[model samples]
Target: MVQSQTHTFEGKTIDEAIEEAKRALNAEMDEIDIRVIDHGNQKRFPFGRSRAKIAVSLTESNDETWETWLDNEIEDQDLFDIPLSPDEKQPVNTAGTAWIIDGQLHFHQTAEKKPILVIPYDGEVYNHNEKLSGRHVLKENDVIDFHLETTLIETKWTVKVNDKEQTVTLTVTPGKKIIPYIADHPAASVIEPIVQFDEQVNNQLQTKDVYEQLANMEVIEGIDDAAIHRACSAGEEQTVTIASGKLPKDGKNGEMAFRIDIQERSLPYKEKHDGTADFRESLYIPSVEHGEVLAEVIDPLPGEDGISVFGDVLQAKDGKPVIIKAGSGIEIDEEQSAVIAAQSGRPLIEQSGLLFRMSILPKKRHPGDLSIKHGNIRFIGDVEITGDVNEGMTVEAEGNVQMQKNVMHSTIQSRQNILIHGNAIVSAITAGQNQAVYDALQDIVPISSPRTDLLSP
Candidate 1:
């Protein structure tokens, strides 16, 4: 959208001078995007030989954009548009007659014989007096003068000299008021002067509350509670504190709005240390928390190792083995055999073998197998399936549980071991550890198993 602007310059015509101003303003059009729309005649000397001095107001695309555009225009012209021409010749009628010392009539007086009338001259005002008065009697020194005056008749109509129509009042008598005229002209207002005290007061007020808070609060090594509180209260202005040096005023919402210079603290030790016997530095250290260590060994000894080991054993907790170790050629009495046989009841396994045992049975008896029907499911622990698990079902067990049939769209988890007996089909299966449980089911199949039943005729 094109914007309007007023540019004033003295030239022979309004258009010529206005075009010159526009050219000067548009010289740097590539730098600042400014487009002039139209020019307005602010104060025009229509009947003047004074080079038609005018305040040409024109419109631009944007007002703010015009400032830089005007700057560029001034730089390009190397001068303001203020005209440097001689004074203009006023209109004949409105141009007052010279004094009698110069033998001029006091036409400004209402009683002059041939008065040169000035009826608030705005532009060229013409007078039409068709009925002319014949030559009047005059002496060698008769004052032949005229004065421009306005007379109100019956408070209804007004008569003003120098207007084109001599009989009645014309609508164009008040061509344009001078107040608005001057306002529209270029350089109408002076540039404002800067007040340094006002700027300083504003800066002080901006940081007054923050400084007050900083002064009131306790000072600590790493915590600036007062500064933080002040910053929080300040909302948008915040301050930051350095660890071992003065607090920096560069933080957001605390103190300074932008960046501020701050000296960083030196390192604990200097690069080149002076050889002094009494030289010592106190360093601030943070407290560290102690944590348990977890280490893994291939063949661990009994007393010498942190974790005890047993063959065919899984874990030991509280000085008791969850799974017993069985070695080759080791004979067991009747009582020991019964105990061992009773412990080897069922093995619980996990879905992913990385977690729990895989392909091994547990020595202790466990709860019976649990089965689920169709639906999407997730299990937290191990699960045992006695019968066929339908599609889209999940089974979870804390301990190992065996399955009889194939599971579909489900998961099984176990802490110990998992054993499968019958054929498992049409499902996803996961195991925990490498040898946590045993899978005796020979017909175990993945979801990608071949569809032999579909191919049959």
Candidate 2:
């Protein structure tokens, strides 16, 4: 037979056109030269349908002699016109795929360009009682079957019911399905086989299978069917919750929010522009005017009950009530649920367990030396010491601290200002007590040197 040196073919896609060329030339992929004339447009179809076209020719290295062509009378035949024997046809390694969309079969690939799949030719696959073959989109409820056979894929999973019996979860390691096909042989590529994968469970799990698992675990309440379906079809390793239970919400505790510095009763220091402590700047003293509101009371709330998947009721705790008492220069406003100052001085709070007392003092005077007889003086108002403070004596005041005589081997702390008219000998005196305490804390951890771990036991 005398065949043309080159020929052109058209198909739905470039791969299909090449497959046709290979069969016409009776040659392998390497034995031919192919030029893509046109890549078919799947879109803009019907009115402007474009089919993929390719030009194929045998390579110069082809030197095969046709055994029966010389004896035949056929001559000058086109490449496609030449008749092909069963043995002469080459294998075509292409196949079509199918998917279920909106409860209907879709023969073509999805928009995501997933691989085209072909259902294996089996008696099980049917479209309304008729055996199906090739690519065909069927209506809903149409069964799609194919033999999935493989041994290399691995799948493992575990179903866990939470200790509270409030949830059910599945931890799965999905497996893969490998479907083999032959290219040139048109028959094998068309009829895809369907078989069950040899594993603990197939990666392609059904929603019903998951529903059965949840039923076995006795998770009847709040069973999320959608979540179970998504997990079954994910075909990847993941932990998914198939059921859930409501949780109990605890009540809020009662609280008292102070608007002023009644807890610490300290003065705040000023900082320089360069972020350094400016000791020259006077610290701001925290004091309340008469009738100023000190704190607001927050009411407690009752908690809500919850239910478990096993139909068990979970009880919740109620919040506790808060109380506030007025001390010297302070009054409680029951109508506003607030603590108000009766006289202006310095606000203070004394706590004994859950009970709280709010107070304010104007000043405290000392007649003589601060010795063992006088004991240590701790006042929220200004303090005036007439005589010297002996060794081991301590004096702390939220307002100004004035010393008339010498202080020796003693400690004096004032939140606002410290005025010493007499000499302070071997004494530790702090004007801004809060700032001094903060500075002392910083010195405890030296960043520039190897330091010991104070927290280590």
lDDT of 2 by residue, 311-355 (tens): 677787887767667778888887888778787565656655446
- Location of the lowest summed lDDT over 10 successive residues in candidate 1: 285-294
Best by TM-score: 2
What lDDT score goes with residue 444 in model 1?
Answer: 18
lDDT tens per residue, model 1, 1-457: 3634555565555556555665766633232333333333445565534454455444434534544565565469643233333774532221112222121222221122322222223222222322213232222234443222332221111212221211111111111111111111112111111111111101112234433432343222233345433333332232333112222122111111101111111224323246542211211111101111111112222221121111111232222112223332111233322111122222122222112121223222223332321222122223444565554444433346577655544555444566767655655565555233223121111112111111100
Task: Assess every candidate by TM-score.
Answer: 0.16, 0.42
- Stretches of candidate 1 above 4 Å error? 1-201, 205-212, 223-457
